[model samples]
Target: EAAVTQSPRNKVTVTGGNVTLSCRQTNSHNYMYWYRQDTGHGLRLIHYSYGAGNLQIGDVPDGYKATRTTQEDFFLLLELASPSQTSLYFCASSPPDGSNERLFFGHGTKLSVL
Candidate 1:
């Protein structure tokens, strides 16, 4: 079975604060992604990694960064964050390659900035 889990399900931060969201997958998948889900824009990819120590830039990598320390762990880092970056952040994992298949998402980390 495949599963993704995130810490601090909810967060409230002041603008320009530092935040870190952690993710872990049990499937040992090689593909991991970080995305933010907004009201109507749907899920926008942030950063992804193909394997440990390997990072791939995505459509929305600005204002955010990612690190894949292990096959089962990935982390999203937000430095100098702003209100615009506030959204429901999700972490996902897929098979070795993005097989044009569905992604397994974490419960989500709801972030609010003020």
Candidate 2:
């Protein structure tokens, strides 16, 4: 099974602030993703990467950016964060053959933008 870990489990910041969420995946998965969980929006993908130095923008990309430095490391950056961006963020990893591969998610990172 894959293992995912996130840092700064909780974060608090004001509007127009900045926050960086880090994630590491132990398994050598080909795909890594960052997602944000909100009430009505459900789980929406913010960014993803297929491998090192690769990035793919997701459904919501206004205030979020991500980079995959290595197969096991991925980072999400929130520049000029806003109140609406406050939510539970999750990092996940999946194998290449996603048809039957299950994603492993980190505990979660709760961010509050005041």
Candidate 3:
């Protein structure tokens, strides 16, 4: 089974503050992703990576950045956080490159910006 872990679980920040969400997947997969969930947006990908030193900007990459440090580690950065950026963040990993790639997601991190 694939396992993905995210740190802090929850976060609270003021407008213009900075936040960093951390994620680690331990399934030896080749794809990792960061996404944000909101009432209207649903689950929107912010950033993703396939392997170490491989980073891909996702659909909603305006206010986020990500880095993959190793096969099991990935980090998401929210440098200039804002109230509109508040949402539930998730980390997901998919199986190795193949036909039936399944994505498994972490619990989530609830971020509230005031």
* Overall lDDT per candidate, in order of appearance: 0.91, 0.92, 0.91
Q: How would you encode candidate 1's per-residue C-alpha lDDT over 63-88 as one tens digit per residue?
A: 99889999999999998889999899
- Residue lDDT tens for model 2, 7-113: 98999999999899999999888899999999988899999998999999899978898889899999999989999999999999998873647889999999999
Off by over 4 Å in 3: none
* Winner of 1 and 3 under TM-score: 3
Which stretches in model 2 have alpha-carbon errors above 4 Å? none
Query: Candidate 2 lDDT (Cα, whole model)?
Result: 0.92
Residue pairs of candidate 1 with colliding backbone atoms: none
Per-model TM-score, in order, reads 0.94, 0.94, 0.95
**lDDT for 71 (candidate 2):** 95
Screening candidate 3 with a backbone cut-off below 3 angstroms (N, C-alpha, C), the clashing residue pairs are: none
Query: Which is the leading candidate under TM-score?
Result: 3
For residue 53, give model 1's deviation from the true position in Å: 0.4
Give the runs in model 1 whose Cα sits over 4 Å from its true position. 98-100
**Number of the top-ranking candidate, with lDDT as the measure:** 2
